[model samples]
Target: MKVGIAGLGTMGRVHAEAYRRMGANLVAVYDANPDRLAGFAAEFDVEAAASYELLLRQVDVVDVCTPTFTHLEMAETAFALGVDVILEKPLALTVEQGEQIIRAAREAGRRLFVAMVVRFFPQYRRAAELVRAGELGRVSVVRLKRVGFLPAAGWFRDPEKSGGMPVDLMIHDLDYARWLLGEPVSVMARRSPALSGQALEHVQALLAFPGGEMALVEGGWAYPPGYFRTGFDIAGDKGLIEWSSDQPEPLRTLFPKDEPPPALGLPMAGLEEDPYELELRHALAALESGGPFEVTPEDALAALKLALAVRESAASGRVVEVA
Candidate 1:
């Protein structure tokens, strides 16, 4: 399928390349930055849209690759013009804006899929599969740890643009937790800014759900060297599943084998050699499937709500019930 991409920043460039590798034609491209646009056009050998309006006309799906601030407005305009959309994460800066995007898509008879690419990662897919199969019966606990250095620009160091870790990074972990187990009933969290209040440098959160299920999430954009990690330790009645990217074998499961200890399952398959390529394949698969991509718009909103709930809980210093 032909897809148009907006923005030519890091993500936009990666996605454009992903489309090329996946055999999806990059029919149109847009970027307000002249330098970025020219570099992207040179690198991809694709048509440069004279204007955003012109780009949409040549593509069946519009990939919203712009920043968070521009996402809602762009998605609304794209869907209102009658093309399906692939929205980048944190769905929107606010729940109201997210709802409006959803409303616009529904009213226009269009599809909206969020690019929560973690769900496409093989480790996560295996974890979710194990959880669903009851081999890890009734998952009762999840632990996610992610800490890393920030992007050089507005990705984290600018609250006005990035919304700090709660939006830029933590939301991914939060969304994965909710997507894997279920939504939490309440969340308690602490948020702290670094040397400057320009952005948050640390966050700690505890999510509690019905049936005694729980998650402890720790993440930040301040770190030494460099760090980026995900997946969790999942505990259940029949078995325990462990996932970690740093390990050679990212997933291992234990089950009672009627022995002194237990039986261990094989290691998880390697993750996609390239994530952006996997995203392109999944997006096209969804287009062919007629609905329900790996990341649904409703799931995206639910994840954003949890992130905002963390902000609310931290600001108020009280447990915030998810709406």
Candidate 2:
């Protein structure tokens, strides 16, 4: 498949490498930053498109790895040009923009796949499988967290640009939670207060789903420099499954000793496969087979809606109902 990536930042570089590893034809790339774009183009040995339009024209699909605010423009342009899109999550800055992207893709007959990479994480994927198979029978509660050092004075720190920690970071777990527990009916959230100049930001959201399922998703840009950690604990009537990045052996299960251990593959224990690669591979395979994306455009929109609800609740200090 012919692919192009916009934005030469961390995720853009990651996607480019994954495509290279998959032997995809990396046709071209475009970025607003000339120096970064030139360096990336040279490193990947791909053409540097002079404009986003050129990038879309040169590839069968484009990876819209740009910032949240730019997703609509990039994605709509790709759809208008009859190119499929691999959009990085959170799909768009708002639910309306997300719906527009999905609508445009449907009108243009192009596939729109949201790159919710957390779903492809070995541990996360395994956890979902176990939950779906009733191993975690009737999951009642889930706790998810991701905390990392705050970026200094950038679009990431700007709520208007990157949607802050809630939308940018917490959306991963929020989406994962929705995948595990289904759509949430309401959300209540709290944000750390009185931190000036975006020094530190943290948010905790409690989501309520049908059948008494609940998820507590905590995200922060308050960690020390170079520190990052993520993990989740899923609890149900039968038992619990958990994993943490800080753990030496990552995944853990607590259940009766007599029960046979789950048959998770080698990658689950070691994280041998990069989640980004796995995600892109799944997208490409589904595209080729005319199958469905694991994280559909609608699913991405739901996740974005849920994340926005969390933001609304945090800002207003009231529980917000998700429509």
Candidate 3:
């Protein structure tokens, strides 16, 4: 499949590398920053389109890896041009914009694949499978943690642009929690104030589902530089499941001294296959075969809704209903 990347940020670079690793036809890339555009073009050996429209014209699909605020504009443009869209997570800054993106895609008869890569992770996938197989009968409780350093990008520091830790960092587990359990009916949360100049934030959310299942999800950008961690604990009537990145295993992440903290999350330590590549491969195959995507547009919207509720609950110190 021919692919074009719409931004030269960290996530954009990661997607470009994943496409190359999968042997996809990476036609071109675009970025508003001239320096980043030029540098990324040279580094990837791909053409740099002067405008997003020009890049869209050259590929069958455009991967929108830009910031959260730009998602609506970029996705609408892709749909208008009859190109499939692979949008990065936190579908939009607001649920209204997310719904518009979905509406536009449907009207244009184009495929929209939200890049919720957590579902593609081997460990998470296996856990879901085990649950499906009745190994964890009547799962009742879940706890998830994703803590890391502040992202390197300036825009990420602005709550207006990145939606703070809830939408940017915690959305992964929020989505995963929903997938593992079910739709949450309400959410209660608390958060620390953003640190001066650092944009560091932390939040913990409690989600209640209609089936009496409960989840405690925590996310933060308050860790020391180069320190990142994630883990989960799941409990059910029949069994319990647990895993952590802190174990003396192959899943611990380390960053080089010269590199800045990653924009979204840390580059995972070691795995048999990269989850980003797995996600893209599935996207390509599903687009070609007209099969359903694992993470659909509605699923992305629902996740964003939950994350926004978390932010609201934290700010108000009240429980917010997942409407």
Candidate 4:
């Protein structure tokens, strides 16, 4: 498929590299900043479109790697032209806009794949699979932590542009939690207030699911510069699974005494290829084969719903029900 990228920032370059690695046709790229667009096009040896409209006309698929606020407008334009879209996470700054994007895709009859890259990570993927296979029978508790240094991009610090930490950074685990435990019934959360000229905010959320399943999710940009970490601990009736980025092993599984442990081949280290690359390749293949995507538009919407509820709960100091 001929793909064109919008926004020549970090994610835009990442997607371009992935397409190149897969030997796919990356026809063109566009960015609001002309200098960045030119540099990226030169580096990738692709045409630099003068504007988003021109780029849209040149490719069969448009990858919207722009900021969270720009997603809906770019996606709507692509769908209007019968072009498929690969959108980055948070889908949109608001649930209403996310719904609009979904509606546009349905009307245009084009596939909309949202890049929730955490799902493609080996450890997280294995955990979800084992949960589905009942290796971790009747999961009772899940604790997830994703904290990192502030983004270099100033836009990320702006609540209007990126939906701040709760929506942008936290949504990954929120989505993954929903993927593991099913839809949450309610959410209660607490967040540090954004201080004057502060770029960091921390949030801790509790999600309640049916069958007494609970998830404690924490995400933020509160760490010191150049530091990032992610980890998860999941417990069930039969066994336990855990992993931490700070640890040497990527995954660990334990079973109770007298219970025969299942034979599972888990990756002790990270994959050779970037998870973003794997995610984009999967989207492209699904687009080509007319197969269902791993991260569906509806799944993205559900994740967004949960994230927004968490934001509300934190702000109001009350539990918010997920509709």
Highest-scoring model, lDDT: 4
* Candidate 3 local distance difference test against the native: 0.88
Candidate 2 residue-wise lDDT, 1-323, digit = tens: 78899988888989999998988788899999999989999999999999999888888888889888999998888999999999988898888888999999999999999999999998898888888878866799999999998876488877888887888889999999999988999999998883776647788999999788899999998988999999999998777998999887757878767776555432444467789989999998888799988898899999889888998999999999999
lDDT of 3 by residue, 1-323 (tens): 78899988888988999988989889899999999999999998999999999999999999999999899999999999999999999899999999999999999999999999999987677667666766656889999999999988888888899988899889999999999888999999999887777788899999999989999999999999899999987787766667687875433223344555333332344356899999999998999899999999999999999999999999999999998
Scored against the true structure, residue 61 in model 2 reaches a CA lDDT of 86
User: Using Cα atoms with residue i matched to residue i, what is each candidate's TM-score against the true structure?
Assistant: 0.92, 0.95, 0.92, 0.97
Query: What value of lDDT does candidate 1 attain over all alpha carbons?
Result: 0.79
lDDT of 1 by residue, 149-182 (tens): 6776664465566666787788888988998778
Alpha-carbon shift of residue 190 in model 1 (angstroms)? 1.9
Candidate 2: stretches off by over 4 Å: 258-270
Ranking by TM-score: 4, 2, 1, 3
- Runs off by more than 4 Å, candidate 1: 197-200, 256-270
CA lDDT of 100 in candidate 2? 93
Off by over 4 Å in 3: 249-271
Report lDDT per candidate. 0.79, 0.88, 0.88, 0.91
Clashes of 2: 0
Q: In model 4, where do residues sit more than 4 Å from their true spots? A: 267-270
